[model samples]
Target chain A: MSLINIFSDYTLRTVALGSALLGAISGVIGTYTVLRKQSLVGDAVSHAALPGIGIAFLLTGSKNIEWLLLGAFISGWLSLYIVNSIIKNSKVKYDSALGMILSVFFGLGLVILTYIQKIPDSNQAGLEGFLFGQASTLLKRDVIVMSIVGGAIIIIIALLWKEFKLLSFDPEFCQVSGFPKEKLDLILTTLIVIAIVTGLQTVGVVLMSDMIIAPAVSARQWTDKLSVMVILSSIFGGLSGVIGTIISSSTRNLPTGPVIVVIISAISIISLFIAPGRGIIWRRMRDKKNKKRLNRNIILNSIYNLNIEGNRIQGYSLEDLSISKGDFNFPINTIEKELEKLETLDLVKGKDEKWYITEKGINEIEDFRGRLEE
Target chain B: MNVQIEIQLIAIVVALACSTLGVFLILRKMAMMADAIGHTILFGIVVAFFITHDLNSPLLIIGAALTGTLTVFLVESINKTKLVSEDSSIGLIFPLLFSIGVILISLYAGDVHLDTDAVLLGEIAFAPFNRFVVNGVDIGPSSLYIMGAILIMNIVYVSVFYKELKISTFDPNLAMALGISPGIMHYSLMTLVSLTAVGAFDAVGAILVVAFMVGPPTAAYLLTDDLKDMIFLSGIIGTISVVLGYWTARIFDVAIAGMMAVMVGAIFLLIFLFAPDRGLLSIMRRKKRQKYDFAQISFLMHVINHEGAKDEREELGINTIHEHLGWNKEFVKDIFNNLYKSNLVYIEDDIIRITDKGRDLAISNAEEIVNGI
Candidate 1:
């Protein structure tokens, strides 16, 4: 398949559109989840939704995405509620609750699915698509349903932006200011559930969390403001959706969810390393530069002290500096390099093998000491 | 032994192995790490398999366990950078690794015996068919022996280092002060988790291993305060789930591992709701009882404080006392009635007076409150 085929092909277009919409919705909701440190809650909810899907199929005897998703939404919401209750009611830790609920619900789901498999009906064939997601099987109608639901979620988020922002950043203040913190939390959690449910067809249960987490994490590296972060995260998510779709479609034996996960992970890693201000690479580079400047100053200050101690203006060898430095493990080569750098700054002048501190170097030391005292 | 008995034995051993270590994982708040390791170890097995080209090689278990510890190291490193929170760090690392594992399995589906379904939902029913043989003499199923050995290993490890593990888990700083390296204990525990996960994977699959590990221990945590009791109770819970889950699956003709997981959840829900002291129902009941007790104590203290004072008539009048206490009239009346029935306070000439017993109780309660106990 070629690039143009992605648009011209009907199935590919619907799949791409569905994946992109799913990505954008999850990305927007993910910003709040990640900021609130509820990232793994998405993981638990997605896994917990599996049993609901299986039960829905069992009860309805049909594979209608709507009914299945409704079931998914209920159970996913229920799982989050139970998790919250566990934390509030017992000594069980958050991670333990999350892991236990996630696995047990998923286990129940497998039981239902297997029971369905023994039902002797071929309709159960495609139901397993929810496990790893069959993005290629997404129909036009499914995309339309996703769009309408996704549009409603986006609207709700816009209307509740202030409350949601306050809830995410400072729930105590949100409570103190007369907002119903519990109700707001329920609404936020519901929205997160809907986002995970919408993307389940494309990303599946096992890997759906990356859809909610990676985009926000990547976008977070690029900006500090919530609005920009939200927009950037959605864009990263939507772009990965399209790109992953095209790549997966063009290849053989590639699942769209994992491929997209790999791509977004790449983006997150890149952002972590190269983004300005918070980027690891930039921080490391800045630290290196600061250390170099500090080393240069230390060498300059030492030469000034040696001159004052000798009570004479004289050149000194590298050995003299090393002797004065005592047990400080500044390597001999590093000291030599600092002296050469000082000579270039005109802070020191070296003739033959001995180095002498210039007047500028002496004044620099005095100024540093004056600033320190002040 | 028959196939049914063999499968149940394998599951029982797997559950025991998981729940033994699960107590520490939950206590240390690293239960999700078990979930992460459960998934990421698949990547380790795949890499090791690709190298050894043998499914039963000991190197696979070693490699997978190493990968599990590596997952912890990576998550902690990302957490150290403070670029992402710990939960997101976990959420990020495992999927990427698991996805790679899945993609690899799919890409080489012909060469590898592993399938994505088996990775997520294992086929434990087939365990009996893979019989272990030595010198042409058939022993029990290979997984039965494998899981049995792992269970013994876990028991030995926990019993030998029970003190160290207990101290380190409850208070890492104290453990450090006592010259026990929390880091070593953590890594060693993670290594065992990985080993147990790999062994259990052949029986319960990657995902359900988390159920076996977290569900029983968490439910047991609700039922017991003692660490030793919690560990023992979780193992018992795991055993019950395995036996019941096996029979339930047999009757319903469904997946055994999945039913076992469901059983674990069901048992947990029961304990969560109905455990004697720490359960939700009891906690709510305690809260209600404490509310009335606190209100009655405050009422008695008020009467004692105003006894024979100049404002006693004005302050201790039942109708106006509600106003002073800022409580609803009906609630105040209810508390007053209860206090009068208990002989703690009596109304005479419309002024409430505290009895000697009530005065003693009120003074001691006030002292306790003042002492911050």
Candidate 2:
């Protein structure tokens, strides 16, 4: 591809659209999944869809995407039901339930697929691709289906937005307040199952949840507002899809799904280091600046202690601590810098490199170390 | 019929192992770890295949188990950082590796028979076909043996370290204070889980592995409060559900693993709705009974207290009396009839009378009833 080819309707409307839709929806739903701590529910349910598709292929011997998808839906729903049952009935937390179902169902799928492979059957084409996915192979029809599913997800999420927000934030409260938590939970889960089943072919269950969660997670780092989070997540998701398909289509055997995940990971890394609030870079810088202030304050307080004892504080060496501590070379240098800073403020005086605390420095030190009170 | 029997045998062992691992996984809140690890093991398997050049080689299990268990370490390590939350870290790691595994298997080892599809959904019917035999006399399934050895190993490990596992799982801080390294315990658990998944992978693959791990333990968890009981119940539930799921697969002509998982779900739902004390229906039944008994006694007490006449008024107010009783009005009439027939009360134009026995019982044992003693 040339640039013109890349932008052409043929390339833009088929693979790009499907991946983008799948990625964006995953991004949106993934936010809640991540925050509510049900992120693996996506992966688990998606994996669960495998056996359903396999069995469908076995029984129907028909390669209709719809039939396979119906199988995917049943199995996916069944997996979710199992997870819910585990969570509701047992002391096993939701994460464990999600994990358990994810492995067992996918394991069962593998067992089935292995058997299918041995039986000399050709009906399981594209079933294995669902373990990951090939976005480059996504068709215009697949794009249409994905977009419709994505649209339905958006609308349902909108309708249940309030209840979902409440339930996600405080399910116990939702239950105590009588907001039909069980039905709401069921509906929310159903929507997720539907989404997983729909995406089984188009995105493959393997990379889909990462597509869903990565954008939302990266978006969360960029913004505190929910709407902004959703919008940013969708954009990141769509952007990842577009970029992932381009990269994969450029090289044969390059997977669209994992590449999509890698792109999202890059964005998340950027936001984690550079975004405000909890961003690493911001905190590092803030800590550095705070350290300078702390050093100055500590040195000034030490000088004030000498003054309170009515000593000249002129014969002091820098090495001093009530407890065993690190070496004094760095501390001495830190003290010199603070002394200079205090001198500029007229809070300290130096005679031949021996420093004494002025009244102002004493007062400042007293203020920095607040009065102890009961 | 023979295939179904063999599948059931495999499923039972697999379910037992999965459920055994699941009890710990759920307790540790790392259920998705099993799922993520299962998929990621494809990469390990393929890598092992490259090195060992045999899909069935023990090296594959070693490499795959190492990778699966390390996947846990990776998830936890990533989670410790601020960049990715716990779930996000989990979501990110496995699929990337899994996708790599899938793509590589397709490109590098397409003919190796251990592709992504085989890792996701496996057939239990074919499990028996891959036999480990000595001198042409078949001794059932090879996978069954692996699962059995693992089940015994895990049962022994869990049994020997039951208190430690419980302590670490329930309160790691306390466990640490008591000289147990919670991290080590967790790692051991992860190792066991990965080991179990790899063994089961040969027989049932990943999806059913998760179902077996999660379903029975959860059902059992709901039915019992005791840890030992929960373990036994979960094992029983896992075995029963596998048989039932395999049976359903036969009846419906559907996939065995899928049917098995659905069967587990059905059992869980059944337990959810009707498991004697913990089921929703049981809870409802208990509530109904409580309401009935409360109303019966309250009506009996009302008759006793109002036998002559209310000190403040000629007739007792039902609302006032109910307010004092704090019971639903719906049960009052039914309780009144039962009281009347039992001679606990006789109503003459609603001026109720409490027999002497009713008065004595109400006064003497009111506190005991309130306390449910």
Candidate 3:
């Protein structure tokens, strides 16, 4: 479907609007997620929500998104509670508790989901889709709720942005300075849960986890500053939602959830491999160029050394020293380039018979050898 | 009747595997990877099924386990690069794999009896239907056997390598200095986590695989300090959660596994507010007690410093008040035993006296408190 068609298409618009708002919230919340080093808290809390959703559905016999999502929100909060408790009570770290709560809650969720699947009375066929969200199911009204929640999340993030950043960097310092580190942490966690629960109604479960993580990953690659990371990640998230909608609408059988997921992953990969300082490919290219420059210098120095060895400073064939230089030279053209550079530097003389080292070249070669030995 | 019990046994076996693996994951702080592995295994399960053309074959688990291993590598490699953060790496990798799984399900496995979702998170209530048979006599659920095998492997692995795991977890750099490969230990831990997730998938699905892997350990951690104690407590907590959760579900007529998870969370919240030392109530209690003792000590020192008092007796009546120090009558009684035990004062029936030893000690303590030492 085209752009005009997308506007007219309720399903497409609903999912796009819902996901965009949700993305903004995750981005805003993810600032804290990345800063607090609790970035995986998204997946942890999301997984933590599962068993609760299953329990809610099982108890209520209702498919109402609110009740189920509330259950999820409680579960997510509970995971955070357990994480904090582990950190406080034992010597175990936050990541471990995070890991523990994440797996256990999700495992329990799965078990319940499987059990629910067998229950003849429950019509829970599409419940698994909630694991990886499907924004396509969102109605126009749901989009409105998502946008409101998204707006609120952004506002909350904006208000406590400094406190959150300060607290995340060093809670001890914040506490010493009389800032409420626990309160800030709670606010961040609460906002994250809100973003996640809002997304839950749209994207579902598993993909919701990715959406929370993906924008931050992309944003992190693009910027070092937290403010910039939050903004950039939100933009990527918004783009993924819009793009995912377009793809999902064009294809009949394709759903928006996986398409959105793929788009986000694509953005992450691009950022990972091609973004400025952090990009893998750029660094690799830089490393290769530096090595090439080093090889040229090595060749130039090798010729200068041969001339300074006190052998009449006469023509020495390239074949005479190729093995001695450890075969560092690449090709005939490369050798010619280095020799030309040496001549240009006025460090050598006698072009045709094999270059002779000038006094300047001799001194330089001796210095290079001395430095290498040292 | 027996079949239902066998099905429940399958879940418990998976829980056993998860708890064993969960402890290491908790120790390594990589417990959330169970969620990543659970979701990504969907792709491997689908791919394996397409290749083998049979969903129930052992190849599915093997292929999924392999992918789970690969997922660990992907996440770890990203972690090593120091480019992407840990959570972001996990959030990035698992979704892509899961998306691939979702796509495969849509394009190819949509019509299969065992679809991607089903295979990724099998039916716990129906696991008993897929029973093993030998010589025409029915054995227990195949899942029970699979999970049992995994649980045994994990128990043996953990039991044998507890010291190694403890060493590596607390200080990986130190472990490396002492001739241990932290990387090896880490990958081994992830492997156990992945194996647990895969084995549990047939009975508990992906999320519970995560829940079982993380919940018990976290709760246990909240209640204990020692690692050895944490593991044992976590195992007990896991089994208790399973049993209690099942009962709650039965009583409430709801989902058993979900109730179990909620129960785990419930127990955790209770312990969070009540456990000793770091617990909310305990910390408050300690603070209140410290303040009360501080006030009492201050009063006792004040009474001893009143040099003009000529009372020969050591007892301070309940009504006695050092009004010049602006003290209350009740505080003298409060400080009586405390000051006497420290030998800072001698109390008779109706008056109190500062002895030579008591006076000297009181002066030193008063100076320390006044100097803020």
Candidate 4:
């Protein structure tokens, strides 16, 4: 099918737009989560939201998105509050509290879900889908609501960018400067809660954390500034949404949330390996070049040191140097390779089976030695 | 044995193993790793099934354990990049791997009995029916044997390495200096955690593994400071929750694993609110008592400081005392009345008088506070 035909499908279009908005908003707000090292808290809150959604359905006997999301937001916030209290008041660490809350809430949600499934005429078919999300089954109205929610989250993040940035980079400074650090932290967490609640429909609880982390990490590879990173992350997140939607729609039985997660992870893995200075591949390449230069300098300095008394010893063989420089213990082939490189740089020349230092090599070695002595 | 009894036995064993292993995980701050390993084991099972083509193969357990360790290795590698925090690295790897497993099941194994729902929340009721028979004779349920072995393994692992684990968990640098290899202990403990997690998977499913692993230990942690006591208490708490959870599930006709997990949280909540030293109620009561003590002492000091002053203007009456201390009238009256009843002060009509007991109490209290400082 053509792009036009794909976009013409109502369900596909709704899912694509809904997930796109979800991704963008998650990426934008999740930058703080990633920076503040609260990425897994998103996972906890999302899982914790499940029971609340189930309870909301049981009480209202409806599948209304707004009511379910409201329930999710309240419970998600409650779980976070519990986590904060646990960390502050006890010897339990942060991750343990997060893990404890996550599992207990999700288990409670499972009980509620199983109970709700048994209730007659409950319309709870779609409730289980929240575990892994079912964006492909989203309706146009749901999409509209998600977009509005996503838009509001984006606006809040934008309006408080400076404060959030200050808080992320130097929270102590922000607090010392008389900023309401606690209130700002609450606002940031609430925004994260909003993002997770909104994205719950698209990615589900189990996979929602990836939507927050992958894009922010991928964006972090390409920039140092917070603003640039946030923008790039949102773009990457939105792109993954489009790609995942297209793939899931194309393939039967492939879920949208996991597919989106796979696509975003691919993007992140690619960015981690090949993106400019920060990428692992580039760092490896830079290290290789620096090591090669270091090898050449060591071999050249060793040759200079061998004839320190101005008794010019010409054409020192690779074996002689390897033996004399037992501390470096460089192999014969390694010495030969460095010698070849020195010859190419015109610092040394080879004549019949021996290496001779050129006039330029003498001056360069003297200059390095003078600097070292100084 | 009755299937219900057998199932409850498996739950007890599973809880014992998970709670014991969970103490170490929580101490190492790797509590969330239960969640990570829990989900990643699905990928391991799927891959093992793909390779061996047998869901019942013992290799699946090893495969799951290996993949659980692999998950740890990958999370560490990503963390070493310094590009993302440890939590983000965990967030990054598991979903992608878990998604692959879910997608694989949906695409190819849909017709099989391998339901994602079953993986998340195992059917403990049917666990007994999936029994292990030896040479035409009936043994107990397969889960009972599996969980029994894991429980034994956890017991032995903890006992054998109790000192090393304690030293490493408390101080890795010291362990390293002593050549104890905290890294080896960590990986081995994680492997044990993965093994316990998989053994309990067929009984309590994945997510509740975390609840069992974290909840009981945390409850025990609130009650005791000794590591050995914490382990024993956690085991006791886990067993209680499983028994209570089984009865509740039977009564309510709900998911057994879910009820057990809920029970774990409920027990933790009870301990959190009522434990002797660290419970929330105890903490709040201490604060309340301290506030009362502070108020009483300050009130006594005020009355004593003003009594028999050379300047008549400095004299304090019952009405003037409340204004000077900036306390409410009722509160001041309550304090004054209590002091009067105790013979700490005698309110002579309008002016307050300090008795000998009050002076001795104030002087001794001040000296005690000074010595404390």
Q: Give me the candidate number with maximum lDDT.
A: 1
TM-score of each: 0.94, 0.81, 0.81, 0.92
Docking class of 2: acceptable
True contacts kept of 2: 0.51
- Go through the candidates in order and give each one's DockQ: 0.84, 0.32, 0.36, 0.73
Model 4 clash pairs are none
lDDT of 3 by residue, A1-374 (tens): 78887678777777777777776677666666766666677777776788789888998988777778778888888878867766775565777667656755665676677678878968996677777666667777677667777778778777887787788788889899999777787777788887887777656666777788888888888788888888898898888888887877787667677888899889888998899977999889999988766765676577666655747646666565464455464676666666677778877665565666678876777777788899
Better of 1 and 3 by DockQ: 1
- If both were scored by DockQ, which would come out higher, candidate 3 or candidate 4? 4
**If you assessed candidate 4 against the hidden native complex, which CAPRI class would it receive?**
medium
Worst 10 residues of 4 chain A by lDDT: A306-315
Task: Predict model 3's lDDT versus the native.
Answer: 0.73
| Stretches of candidate 3 exceeding 4 Å from the true structure | A2-4, A49-75, A103-129, A156-186, A225-227, A297-350, A356-374, B115-121, B159-166, B170-180, B219-234, B266-373
lDDT tens digits, residue span A124-204, model 4: 899989999999888888888988887887788788888889999999999999889999999999989988998998889
Please give the lDDT score at residue B23 for candidate 2.
82
The complex in candidate 2 yields a DockQ of: 0.32
User: What TM-score applies to chain A of candidate 4?
Assistant: 0.93
Put down candidate 3 lDDT per residue, B38-142, tens digits, no spaces. Answer: 788877877877788765577777777888889989987887778877777887798898887877777654565556556555557677888678899887777
